[model samples]
Target: MRVTILGSGTNLHPRRAAAGYLVKTDNLFLMDFGPRTLSNLLKTSADRHQIQYLLFTHYHADHFSDFITFFFDAVCHSKFVSPRADLRIIGPKGTKALFGTILRTFPSFNDSEFRVTLKEVSTRSFSIGSTRVTPVPVTHTDRQTCLGYRITFQGRTLAYSGDATYAPNLIRLCRDVDLAILDCSFPKNRPGEAHMHAGECGRVAQEAGVKRLVLSHFYPIADRFDVKKHAAQVFRGKIIRARDCMTLSV
Candidate 1:
């Protein structure tokens, strides 16, 4: 499996983009759709039209904002040229309602030529093409549903922590995976609410026994500290700091 970091920074970070990732195996799979998601993906070998499935972790603006442009701009443009196959979107509970509201607000979105299917998922496992996806509920805002995804394709497992604090569900989702892409939003010294620091991420990586840990969702404050060094203090496994446009083979 191949994974690309489309955007790895938090909402507050100016230089780095927001949270988003693109995975390629049998098909293109996207996790989260933050501000720079489409733009960053365009820089790579892939584009928004190539994405087969889109999995959202939560409805936070930093994570799901780009969906507006993706649907309106890309899908609309593709419709005039050559509409691709169905674009399947899976997310936590209320996803269908959310998209319904979007369509209600802008009814013109329903006039698209391309097909879009939205599926609201919970703590369940399902398959999309060759990939098996499992959503593990995690702790975040009380107002909205949050989850981390464990994706298995071609015998390789990749776990992504959307926006979570220290939760047991996250640990279970990451267990013995090929790659654990965690939310290291803050540095160890500046721990924030509903987010994990480098040391905490190290603990999760260590406890989960993931083969490799890629720390993402970095806040600007974390720029002052050595994130990998801090995570290395607790985790003995390989650690990588995620950057926009960085691609890795898992």
Candidate 2:
């Protein structure tokens, strides 16, 4: 399977776009549609209609703000429409309500030209095609109940920590996975309230025995530090500092 980091920046960072990822097998699957998601996807050669699944980790603006533009484009453009498309959107408990609010807030998206099935995901395992997905709750903020996902496909596993502080569940969820895409939002020395720093990410990867560690959701200030030096301290495997449009195969 191939995984692409579509957008790898946090909400507050303008140099890098918000979070988004594209996982491809026989079909394409999108995870987190942030502010620049549509534009980032357009930059790629991949067809938009190929996306069969959309998974939202949380409702934070950086994680989900681009859904409006994506819906608009998909509804208005024929080329982007999937002929046999069954777009399955999975997220936390309030997913349906959040999507309903989006449609209500934007009348253009309310038109029923396309088919979208919204599903709620908690700390449980579920199936999407041949892939098995497990959601693990993470500590974000009191306002939101965030989740990190571990996706197992074709005997390969990839874990994604969706914008959260260092938590034990994250380590457990990522254990033995081929790749762990972590939220290394801050630099090693710097501190943050709801995001992981480079040092913390390294320790987690070490404990989890993750084969590869990809650091993302980078803040602009994080660029000032030596990420590799910090992450290498604990993680003994491949440590990738993700850039927009970077792809990884596992």
Candidate 3:
């Protein structure tokens, strides 16, 4: 399995793009489509036409604002070509309503070239081609739907924690994963309420026994602190600071 961190920064940062990841197994899987996702996707060594599934963690602008742009770019506007296969969008509860609102707001957007199927899922296991996916509810902003995903394919496992606070559900979802990408949005010295600090992310990865932990989704303050050192104190595994266009093989 191959995983690419297309965008690793938060909405506040100017250098790194927002949350977006590309996973390749039997089929192409994209996790989280944040604001700069479209441009970041073009930078990776991935074929955009091969993307078949999009797993959304929530509807936050920093996490899902590129959905419209992605769809627009996928369609061939000037030339006539065969339509592409349908793309499946799997998200937390209220996903359908969220897209419905977008469609209504953008009346000029057309879906004739390709079809999009949106499905809301939670705490359940499902399949996309040859890969298995499990969505685990996580602690986040109040009244907002957030989730962490566990993916297994060809005997390899990977987990992604998207915009989550420290919680048991996240630990369970990432237990024993070959690679665990977590949200370390704040410095350990200055903790945030809705997102995990470096220390908290380290503790969770340690408790989950992940082989490798990738700290990501950093705000600007994270650049001023030693995020890797903070996480390394608690997690005795390979710690990687996520960067845009970084790739990992499992």
Best-fitting candidate, scored by TM-score:
1
lDDT (tens digit, per residue) of candidate 2 on 1-250: 8898889897767777889999886568888988886688888888887677899999889999888877777777643443446567889999999887887778677664667788998888988778888999988788898889998889999999898787788889789999999999888999688888999999889999999999999989788998867899988999999999988997
Task: Give lDDT tens digits, candidate 1, residues 1-250.
Answer: 8999989996657888899999988888899989877788889888667787989999998998888888887556776787776778889998999987886687468877777788988887998778889999988878878989999998999999999888788899899999999999989999998899999999999999989999999989888899999999999999999989999998
Error of 2 at 171 (Å): 0.7
TM-score of 2: 0.95
Output the lDDT of residue 220, model 1: 93
The superposed Cα distance between candidate 3 and the true structure at residue 149, in angstroms, equals: 0.3
lDDT of 3 by residue, 179-225 (tens): 99999999999887899999999999999999999999999998889
Error at 73, model 3, angstroms: 1.8
The global Cα lDDT (0 to 1) of model 3 is 0.88
- Which ranking of candidates, highest TM-score first? 1, 3, 2
lDDT, candidate 1, at 50: 76
Spell out the clash pairs found in candidate 3: none
For all candidates in order, the CA lDDT equals 0.88, 0.85, 0.88
Off by over 4 Å in 3: 77-82
Cα TM-score per model: 0.96, 0.95, 0.95
